[model samples]
Target: MLAASNRLAGAIAFGLALTLGAGLGAVARGDHVVVHRVGASAPAPTPSATPKPTPTADRSGTVSQQRVRHIAEREGFAFLRPPGRNGEVSRWDPCVPIHYVVDVEIGPPTAAADIAWAIAQVSKATGMRFVDDGTTAEQPDDRRKDVRHTKSGWRWAPVLIALVPDSVFHGKGLHADKDSLAYTDPAIYSDEAGDAEIVTAQVVVDADDITDGGHEDPGALGPTLLHEFGHLAGLDHVHRSGEIMQPDGGGVVSYGPGDLAGLHYVGRAHGCVADAALPTDSDDFPR
Candidate 1:
């Protein structure tokens, strides 16, 4: 369950609880997410398993698109949407590879590697690419930072994946769950046509939730990262039990077939806009 900013949260309600799944298999209830201060950074990825292995191939660990479709039809998949009884799907104007950064305050020894692994899986499934902006010193804030151009001329805000202590969320007495494995804040932008597009996002995991953090096994942490990034990629929780996008503490560890199908559709959107284009005053995606 990924949680957006306060404003975004207000727009979501029980929707964006960040990455609530943890391979525990439990439907999330009362997804009270902590609205922490904002922060983001970057770095090269290096997991303990190996230098980031290639993303799963069509016939790799991830299920095939055919199977994904079958699963979705049999069970069903969900996309993150704007608040309301209606499930209004929120996707990028045109599906495109996404860039991101990794800011680590704490995590497993293979944290970077775990991130890389998760990236490969998502990229393989959605045909999306990830960019590591190196790293940053910004502290985590619950509010959304306006994305724009930095003094360096690069896009100011990119997706940020951070490993932080629980205190960062708990200390603030944020409304998030105590067993919060990780959460994400994906900034949703609308196009001139009033369609939602996800440009930049942030993912935060409890440093203490992973094996190195005295919670789950080091290897088990990869699934948590994958699930949160899934949220970043515009996925919503499904009632289906054995999926990565299930409720918090779910044990799905990897993207299920249904989850993969939704990702493909999201990545398949038509995005003519620049990956980092700022909304114009003449016409902008509703902020």
Candidate 2:
């Protein structure tokens, strides 16, 4: 137990991983991409069951599919469901709240506001609750973690939001590629129903991108934060010019209609189970 406590306080290895963009092919900007490779095994296919039709209604913070489809078609949307995998992008189980731990050291002043606003937006858009589990000294790691050391009082790893120097990352070469602002690597896993859900994630910012982008780019930090969290929410880059999920620069500090549309699609699954097991120790999402 003493050794485990020390281990929690020590440097946790952050393994090298292919950029999440690599999953969609090499799309991360610049040269400094740092995606943490989580589990390497594929989840066993569960017994086949009928998937219900997608929902369409605005209730308790969720938007209607009619509205989502309209927005998706008009503003454009990127359907990044895994390859050879059919249908829409996977989602979190809305039945339970997603708890996150934000490392308060996220820096350069406006960090707190940006983090708050981003999380609020995601919660509002998805109808999925996100309760902040406070700050930590933890650095991002790709491996599975002890949610919390019941005996030692070490907090479980949550969604990390760290401010890292752009010069230190692979996607931040010329200072700002526009696309180098921030990135998220969601630690995905399967729920009881054999569906994929984002159990934990990392939303790291490139500090130099804001610094190099010049004066008061701090305001722009909100969008980058929102974009990274959007990744945590299971969104991929859309070609649309106005959406927050745009591969390049986008229109607002807020999520556009299309971004919300995709969020609507990925917020919750069509089925529910009587019980669920927390998925950190598991492998890649259900296939």
Candidate 3:
């Protein structure tokens, strides 16, 4: 009777293991490392061995392809990654890295006159000038996970207002829309080489909500452009209020001393390993 009962118990345990989809088979039994043999999508166990941080990729290659010409010495910010929901979560997040790329779209029948007006508006708000008279081209549909549409700073082609049905300026942040200002990943992107999959910004213009202050719009669409440009230019938000990065934006229209330093570092050097030593913007990042 005792032998029969022991056999029955073993059978029950084996059945329980099989029922858990194999992934949970390695039931933890105290200090021992339980090796679960589940499906292919199981979360990777944290390495028990000495953890060496993944080395950032070298960014020497593709020098000619970058968009921003001058990198300033400002602090840096990160682009956000796509969050995978459901069973697909493991395939991403800590895995499917996000990249940073900014693209502007134009509205249809708007023509050169409209784009010129828009550029003039943006330039006036930010106190920057655009004298480039480059040729125009059609914007591509698939602007995500691809680099073909990306144009280097020197090769900027002015898009006509007529070609774009609408226009919106975008800035990089955690959400799909720039309604909130948060970055999900800051470190993973610092490497520079593995940042293509990330999203820098995406904006669309609403005819009703346009403004000259740029901050007048909720997207802060104007500031968003500058903010992302600052990132590309290598500026991070400083902790000061009345600065461009402060919430309830106003007054701080131009890049502060901190902003300039960061921009110089990134635009000129492409990397500012010692950016912390440079300076911090007195204005805080948007809350």
Candidate 4:
């Protein structure tokens, strides 16, 4: 869990581990160490684009696309798997719009607006497109299915961001340590060539913590959401202060220069999956 002396200190942490069957799994909190595990599993097939006769709506509501871009970078950033000889960094396909949904059943009154704001922030930083599927009563699950049959049709499950209570948080296998404001579980699959893509993810925020912070105050729910979203975008914790990817919040309310650079590295401007080039050295990764 991301620990802090107080909310103002903005504690956060992230962890990564390999799993069998479907894809790689990673978990993030605030202020924790990252662990990696490797084992052989059949490579999952790459996701193909939605077939013809696409539905106009999904579980979140009417589907619409929103895209933004902000390119910049510097030192003091890191990834779950830094780009270079180690392997390719896993990211969402830039050419496709990422669809997401919010579960606000246990959230504060401002939950919806706060989430929209944070998503926009991440979208701008990463040049990723997002489609809000609106709200759902769906709960967070570590073993959530990657694809589900919806009224529109069968499609990849949209990212789920749930505001959950302590009971649900502990019960749902979110693995949130004590006092963790939020955590993320991202599912990544590698193709035959060893390239990886994040297919779906879950973001679970502690409802009690947000209530205590009143959601909108500095070092409150907003920044926490942003930090977890960073994890969702394939970033891991950095020890540097002033970066949103820092293990602890470091009193930073937004993505710093290093964070922007990291996002750019995984974002559309870097290249979409089909045409994206692999980084060849440590210089391609954040220092």
Using lDDT as the measure, which candidate wins? 4
Weakest 10 consecutive residues, lDDT, candidate 4?
A: 11-20
Residue 23 miss distance in model 2 (angstroms): 31
Ranking by lDDT: 4, 1, 2, 3
Q: Could you give candidate 2's per-residue lDDT for residues 3-64 as a string of tens digits?
A: 55335434221111111111212111111122221111213222111122222332222234
Candidate 4 backbone collisions, by pair: 2-30, 10-249, 12-30, 12-31, 13-29, 13-30, 13-31, 60-133, 73-261
RMSD of each: 13.9, 13.0, 21.3, 17.4
Regions of candidate 4 where Cα sits further than 4 Å from its true position: 1-74, 84-87, 151-153, 211-218, 275-287
Q: In candidate 3, where is summed lDDT lowest over 10 consecutive residues?
A: 278-287
lDDT of each: 0.52, 0.50, 0.26, 0.58
- Would you list the rank order by TM-score, best first? 4, 1, 2, 3
- Lowest summed-lDDT stretch of 10 residues in model 1? 44-53
Q: List clash counts for every candidate, in order.
A: 37, 6, 47, 9
Candidate 2: misplaced stretches above 4 Å? Answer: 1-75, 83-88, 143-156, 171-179, 191-194, 211-219, 268-287
* Per-residue lDDT of candidate 3, residues 1-287 (tens digit): 33543443344444433442223212111111111111112243222111121123423323431211112112321112111121010011211112322223332233234434434433443333345334334332212111112232111112211121222222231121233221111111111122211112222232222333444342334443444344322223333443443322223445545444443332322221221110011111000
Per-model TM against the reference: 0.64, 0.61, 0.32, 0.67
Local error of candidate 4 at 232, Å?
Answer: 0.9
* Displacement of the residue 286 alpha carbon in candidate 4, Å: 38
What CA RMSD would candidate 3 show? Answer: 21.3
* Candidate 2 Cα deviation (angstroms), residue 110: 1.8
Supply candidate 3's per-residue lDDT for 283: 13
What's the C-alpha lDDT at position 141 in model 3?
Answer: 29
TM-score of 2: 0.61
Q: Return the clash pairs for model 2, or none.
A: 31-170, 31-171, 32-170, 32-171, 33-171, 147-156
